[model samples]
Each structure stands twice: as C-alpha cells, then as structure tokens.
Target: MTTSILTSFIIIISFIVKRIQADCQNNTLTETTFVYRRVCYFANWAAKRYDNISRLTPEDIDPFLCTHINFAFAKVLESLIIAPYEEDDLKGWTANSKGMYERILKLKETNPDLRVLLSVGGWTHASRGFNEVSKTAANIKNFVKNSVKFLRENKFDGLDLDWEYPGAKDQGAEPHSKTGYTKLVKKLSRVFKREAERTGQEKLLLTCATAAARHRIEAGYEVEEVCKYFDFVSVMTYDYHGSWDGKTGHNSPLYAMRNERKKFREWNINSSMLVWEELGCPKEKLNIGLSAYGRAFSLFGETGMSNGKPVTKKKSSIGIKASAAEAGKYTREAGVLAYYEICELLQNNPSNRVFWHQQMSVPYVSSKTLWIGFDNIRSVTLKMQFLKEHGYGGVIIWSLDLDDKTGTVCNEGPFPIFNAAKRELLILPDHLINKDKKCSDDNITITIEHLHSKMTKIKQSKNSK
Candidate 1:
C-alpha cells in the first residue's frame, strides 16, 4: 500500500512538472533573435564503421558545435510520401528502444538553439522520387501533408530536400521537372508558414542541397523563384573535380588556377558563386558546402602502394596523369579519403610534401604514386574567411563522421576541422545573421530521458495496482 501511494505521488508530481515545462517552452521560444548557422550533416550509417574510433553515433556529437544538424537522408516513397530509408531510422531501433531519430533529437535537450532537420533524398535516391512527387498538384499536396506530419510528429525543426538535380535528364528527371520543382518548394513554404502562424510557433526551415556546376544550376533551378521559398541554399561546392577527370585536379579549389581556360575556370567556388548570383540567388541566402574529406588519385607509373596507403615519394601539380586512388582504409571509397586518413598519410610519411595552392587558396598532398587534394585547418580558415568576404550565409559540412572525430588520428584534437571552421564562422556577428532567437531557452530543458523514466514508473505502478 505504501509503495502504491509513493508511485501515485510521483505520477502527480511528474504531471505538474510537465505542465510547467510546456508553458515555459511555449512562451520562451519566440522568433526574434538571430545567429549565423554552422550546419553539420550527420551520416546515420557511420555507426557501422569498422572500428571504435572510426564509428560514430549520436553520442559522439557535440550538440553545441553546430547551430543546425541535418540528419542525412530519409527516403521519398513511390507513392509520393516520405519514409525512413534505414530500418533503424524509425522508432524502436532495437526492440522498443529509441532509434536514430530519437537519439538525434535528444541533442536539443543540450542545445535548445540547435535545430535538427530530416534530409530527404540523396544521390542514391536520385531524382526519381522528386520527379514522381512533382507529377501532379495532388501528389505534391499529399507529399507536403505527409512530410509536415512526419517532421512535426518526430519533432524535427524542418525538412531538407536534397533532390540532386531537378531537371537533369541524365538523372532521369521528368520533363519540366524544374518548373515542378519550384512549385513543390513554393507549396511547402506556404504550408509551413501557415502552420507556424496557426500554432504560434516558428516556421519550419526549408533548405536544399543544390548543384554548383553552372550548367547544372542553370538546368535544374529557376534560381530567383526557388530562392524565395528556401531558408537557405546549400551549394555543393566540392567535387568540382575528382578522379573521373583522369588527371590531377582540385576537388574544391576556392579559385581557378591563374589564366585557365574559361571552360575549365567555371569549375571553382568563385565561379560557381558568380553563376548562382547571375541566376538571381542572393549571396545572403547561400551556404557553400564544405567537405571533411579529400579526393585522391593513383598517379600513373608508380608501384608505390601498400594496403591502400600511397607509397610514392614524389608530388605533382595539376594535369599529372592519374586515375582514382585506392580507397582509404576506413572510408573504403575509391578516389576519396577522410580528413583523418589524409592526416595519417602525412604523419606516416615525414618526407611527404604539402603544397599550398596560393591562387586556389587550398592544399594538396604530393607523392610519386598518388595525389590527394583536401583542406587543412589553414585551408578551412581561408574558406570561412571567403564566406564572410563574399557575404554568403554560412557553411554546411558534408558529414560529421569523416572528420578526425575522436582526435585519435589528427592529434590536433577531436573535430579539428570542425573547430577550425567554427572559430572562423563565429566571426560573423549574430544579430546580422538570424533574428529569431529572442526567447530564453534557459527556462525549459525537455529531455526524453526524463519523460521516459516517468512513463516507465507509471506503467509499473499500474501493474502493481
């Protein structure tokens, strides 16, 4: 009897606490202040990485490190509805336990300012889902309804549509998909705005991962119109040049090599940004994509490779004959190496040369058999400065897992690349960037653990009764 009474008392107390918390949250989160966004993309599959240090779960994240976290990829179904791509993405990841969605949302407890968005579609999902969703007005309406419900039910702050290219024919995009794409975005924006007004909450943020190549952008987007609906456009500035070129090239050079052909010159960040501007997107609504990895090449005529690590003792600049480098040990992707792996190569080879491309404002590794182009702390700092100089909105890292996440490899510290970028990005004044931060988040700290504990106890009490 005493135990039952104690349980009842606990339940009442929890109920009261919840009501108070709700009131605080409802009144405290007013959209009136602003801060520059440091958007980090969380790759869900990183949990399966081969080793402890290489693997990352939500527990490994520093919630305060970024202003926004985009959970990389949920899928778009053939029925023109949204769905979780990974089986573990939905609730009950492992027999009634919280899944990736719950784990990531838990971050908000630590950082009330942090907004997490579910990113839908990726390269693998491609444009098919997008093309299908844009097939009709009713399809788009149903999609927006389902999408909004999903995001809200899951407590996501927004949705990031990552349609690779809306109108690229090679990607199997339906004709006039570009126009349809604009219509889709417009509808989402309108619905999100209306919902926010109805509920007295902030509107859900809408962003997109867009193509940086001039031709891609021109063909895929009705730039000025689309920009009006998106909170920001994350231009894919990396992968400007990779192994497919069959020659040495910078993956994301800040600028073109001096006096290059106009055709090739358009490949760099500087030119890409110019093209976006020419197409009518404002500089302030753009966030350039930052990569935490580099592209590597297998230089021709070099027998210097051992277990995927480059064995060459020489370095060459652009135009060196080469193909994609063997996949890095952990990343296991041909032509690509994580920042950590790049660091490992440098650390193992004391004689390896680091070339600072002054004009391109980036760095590359030189060796006889392989060449790698990636960003270091110095390079990242330069890129951040470039964002500020050009008045771009912010930076979006491709994935958090690719960085030296645990400080074991780089020895510079955990998340060295991220920290470097953060320091530079914070240089942007807060008041100038976002004005929706007026409410004090300090008063309300809602965490799933607390609620889950209460629920568990309530169940036990009922069973005892």
Candidate 2:
C-alpha cells in the first residue's frame, strides 16, 4: 500500500514538473539578448480603494513584473524635503509589523534586481515642493540632504520626480521655472552620484516624469540640459484627450488622426516622442509612459462620423461629443476607470461592444452612454514592438495597481497587461525568474503564486518520501 501511494505521488509530481518545464523551455524571453526596462508606478491611494479585491497593497505586487517600481506621490514637505503621503508608508503601524514601503522593498528578496523608488509629486501635488527646492542653492541643498537621508533610511533604490510641469505659470509656476527645475535636476544628479561613491553603494537612478504635450514639453523642459542630467526622462504619453477637450478622443493615440489640425496634430504618442527626440532627449534615455486606466466619457447625444461617414445611427465612440461617465466602482473617479473596472463593465454588459482604432493603435469601449479609450494585450504588444523598432530606452506604466490583479474580473487571468508585457518586451533573467518554472509565454506566466505552490508541494513530497 505504501509503495502504491508513493508511486502515485511521484507520477502526480512528475506531471506537474513536466508541465512547468515544458512551459519554461518554450519561453521566448531567454532568446533575446537585448535588455529592456520595465518601470512601473504604484499608487499608494489604491490601498484605500473600496473593493478589497481591487485594492492593491504591496503584498499584491509581483516584484518580478517590473525592474523598477516607483511608489507614487510622496509629498514635498514645507521644509523642502520628501516624505511619504500615506501613514502606512512607515513601519510600526502594528507590533513588529512592516509598513507598506518596507513591504514593497521586501519584494527584492524574490527579485534582487528590482529597484524601488520614491516618486515625489503627481498631477495632484503639481508643482508644490519642486519650485521651493529650486528657489535657491540653500533650499536645494537642504532638500537634497533630507531626500538622500529619507531614501537611504527607507532603503529605496532611487527617486522619480513627477512634478506636473515646471514652467506652467497658469499652474502657479514661477517665471523661468524651467531653469529652476533644471537646477534642481542637476543638483539631485550630482548629489546622488557623490552619495553613492561616498557610501560605496550603487548610484541611485534619478528619473523625471514629464508632460506629453508638445507645448508643455517645450515650456516646462530645457530638454537638452535636463536630459543630459537625468538618467531617464519619462514622457507621459497618455491623457492626450479627455473631457477637457470637450470632445471624444483617444487617450494615447499612437498617431494623429487625419482630421486633426494645428496643435492637435502633435498630441499623440508617436508625435510626442518625436518631439522628445527633437528636443534632444536621446531615444536610449527616453521611456514612454503608458497607463493602466482608460479615460471615460459620457455620450453627449450625437452619432459621430468615421471616414466622413455617419458612425451608425446609434451612439458610438468614433469622435462623438461626450461628457463624463460615472465614476468607477473602486477608483471612484468619473472621468476614468481602472483596467479592471473597465473589464467589469465589459463583462457585466453583454451589449457593450469593443471597437479598435487602427489609426490610433488602441481599443475603446462604446456603450449607449459612454466611451472609454484603453490599451489591452493586443495594443500593448504593438506598443512594445514600436518601442523595440524605435530603439527607445523602455516603457513605464502609470500605476501597477490599476491592472486587474484578479483573474475573475477580466477573465483573462490576473495582470493580463503585464503578462502581455513580459512576453512582448524583455524577459526576466534566470536569476530573477524561478529556474524550476521558467516561462515567457502570455498564457504561461510563472507568477509568485505558481512558484510558492510548487515549492510547498515539492517540500511535502520530499517529506512523504
């Protein structure tokens, strides 16, 4: 009886092992010698999101999914230094408990190559502390000192500055703020270098997330100077259109529509990146920013046209006039929906149809009353191809948490966008990836859950033997 049971266990274990090995051997990631960067942003506020399943804590993050994860929107304090926006960012919330920041860093235990950064400022934080830091040499010095201390203390790998735009006087930016911003960037770069040499540690990566709009780029960035100083310039290529345009448009159109004119012609991913190159940002140092959320718009009563033809008698997203759609269930923002929220809407409503914009190279959902512009596996694959063909530095996601962490909502398995990314972009090296369960296919993602389960079972089988 013991021999029979042991044989059965070996057979079961062998089957599972064979499946993993087959999947791993077939992985395409190992074939490529070229290294690509995958920088993902983490939205800490998502911790407070209503739906527990949708809420993304550090625990939910797959460290192997990205080379660098920037914790979003650390505040610039009144003292001109950086600090966490959330209380959970620090430890001691409970007895001997780690905080969100440490929890995120601990992911490095699984992926030693993973870099965690503290991203200061966002659209909401705007230009608050940036201008202050740029005010004078003294202010800049104090800010840098504290920033280094905080980052080293917290064990972060680097910093990502997401100051909206530096020269937008309309947004309360001081005159000549671009120069000021440049000074700040240069200082951080210098200090970071010196600090690394002083401590005999790896140099902290210094990146800046900037505007996508051509005009904003020109106004807010002394591109040549800024690019020379920073490690990477992350140009956010989304939000090209929304309710702000008072009309329907794709959020991250790959190319400008033929119908677009004037400044609108330049509002596209390709056009913006071209502008980045034009402004002297080396393609190798340029990382295009993509979003995991779709900008939603409500139908404002019109059957828009396509190719000069009426877009059916029914409401459609083809350049239709629009207002704001209702807020997402978890994101709770009317003008946008998380990818998972969009998936929920698509799944719940069978009548809702998905349409592709060949010209824009993105997908959109058009229901009777709403339109949403978003990227999925198909489009993301195309974008990664574009990245490779253009020889750009890499791709950076707006927020990692927004992707569907649950397989049930999208029915595409968890983190489908990321899964597609792993296949299409760079593959994880063997050191970072589980050697026992190597994989590079979209369907054969070797997630943390997969590795942990296998490890547990293998240990149990050994005990059985």
- Tell me the deviation in Å of residue 315 in model 2: 9.7
- Expressed as tens digits, the lDDT of each residue in 36-59 for candidate 1 is 578999988997687876788898
**Which residue pairs show backbone clashes in model 1?**
32-435, 32-436, 33-435, 33-436, 33-437, 33-438, 34-434, 34-435, 314-367, 314-368
Error of 2 at 23 (Å): 35
**Candidate 2: worst 10 consecutive residues by lDDT?**
428-437
Best by TM-score: 1
Could you tell me how far off, in angstroms, the CA of residue 297 lies in candidate 2 after the best superposition? 1.0
Cα-based RMSD of the predictions, in order?
Answer: 16.6, 14.8
lDDT (C-alpha) at residue 80 in model 2: 85
Q: Give one digit per residue, the lDDT tens place, for model 2 in 1-465.
A: 544565576567557767876766777445534467888888887777777766888888887989889888699876787878888788647888888888889999999989999899888887787787888888888998899999999999999988887998777778767888888889999999999999999998899888988878889889998899888888899998887776677888887777776868988889899999998999989988788889898874446444456554433355676677888878888888888888888888986678988777889987767788888888888888888778788888977778988767788887888767767876443443453444444433444346456667766887887
Model 1: CA > 4 A from native: 1-34, 302-316, 429-465
- For model 1, the local distance difference test gives 0.85
Assess the local accuracy of residue 364 in candidate 1 as a C-alpha lDDT between 0 and 100.
94
